[model samples]
Target: MYSPLVQPAVSGASSGSRESTRDNVLNSVLTHGPVSAATIGDQLQLTAAAVRRHLDSLEKDGLVEVKSVAGSRGAGRPSRRYVVTQQGQSHLGDDYLDLASEAVRLLQEISGDEAIRSLARKHFASLEQRFSELVPEDADLTDRIRALTRTLDEAGFAASTRRAGRGGKVTTLRAAQICQGHCPIQEMAGEFPEFCEEETELFARLLEVDVRRLSTLPTGGHVCTTHVPLGRRAHASLMAHTAQRAEK
Candidate 1:
């Protein structure tokens, strides 16, 4: 569930104190829309000075813009209301890969290719481990493949399946154009060629059946394939076994 409030709750102290303050201020403005710094300070429980400093940082990032408007009844000076720019909204979600890529570029700039490669390997390993958790325990081959397909769909893969024969199933996934637009690593292919390979391997391992990749189908501008298994009912006991495992 998402919060309907103007800002997400602050969890802990941020780096350099002021840096975090700036992020909080910018995020608040982005989430809530045009609001005064004083109103922002009250919401964040930060001092006016601190809010100003943070706002300054945000302005530097081109993430926040201010609009000056006269106060009701024409006050002495116009009040400046802050709002998040389109750029700032990009930073608000877990899907901020552009920011991650910028971080990677900085790391590569400072540390060199070898360092980035090492970091990429470590990161990919972590991602693989996290993805593995989505697997249901004791799920047979077919069900596992279905689950994996569903996971891919959630991850922006336009996944669908077709029954090939009495015992065969073919799964096709088309990648979303939006996903490719933001991807940094040669889009998805060069960055994660191993992605499909691993998915194929997982399906094979979980089902104890041969999972073969078919010819490439056009998606966006690149190509992808269908994952097909030769037979059905090969893993009939999957769900029941999975349930039993859960009971344990």
Candidate 2:
């Protein structure tokens, strides 16, 4: 039963299987993050101990992070939700960003800044079409913003929405901000700037309300932040949106 070659082969296979399971755990965290460990275990059909083991490895490696929230069962213990860190996203990998940035730079040199602006505009127009279709025509600003956030998440932007406020509490101001933890084209956008401008403009056009970029990932902010006014001039914005659609 103890053949040298066969024993090493079995050991290697076991190690490979463990690595595969770890990758699955990491992906589950990314897709359903700010999610609890139990939930991930259930989704992956892994035991609690197994999931925790993988998560501990990921956390130790700086690929996963945890947030403690008040547990519903009682206040004595808090539930931990896991989300991938920026480094974790890098682990997921974005190949050729450097090459893409060089391509955009070349385009700018050949065609000028307006050409880059036009390219950016055209680029986001498709995303606008895809994201807008996910929201209802009469949805309120909260629902609308959340829909956009959902779309962004599905697009791998790692986006989340939060009510914009000063201090730690929700602001009285009627505005919310969309925070994207990861941007696929961050490297390229940093050089051109047109991509960010066009994306902000796209949000305004889709929401039919003026929006602002408070900060951006390329600008050295932790996340890309966009300020969206909530429930202001809804009717006017709707009318403007309708008019724009008609003209197009």
**Model 2: how far residue 229 lies from native, Å:** 2.6
Per-residue alpha-carbon lDDT of model 1 for 145-183, expressed as tens digits? Answer: 555555444443333344443322343331111111111
Judging by lDDT against the true structure, name the best candidate: 2
Per-prediction backbone clash count: 3, 0
Q: lDDT tens digits, residues 1-248, model 2?
A: 00011000111114558987787777666655666878767766777888899899999999988978787677688889887776876777679988878888898899999788878877766677777788878887666677777777667776766665443343336677777766778778888887998787677666666678998767765567788876564357655764563343
In TM-score terms, candidate 1 sits at: 0.34
Predictions in order: lDDT: 0.50, 0.71
User: Which runs in model 2 stand beyond 4 Å of their true positions?
Assistant: 1-56, 59-86, 166-172, 234-248
Predicted structure 1: clash tally: 3
- Candidate 2 has an lDDT of 0.71
TM-score of each: 0.34, 0.63
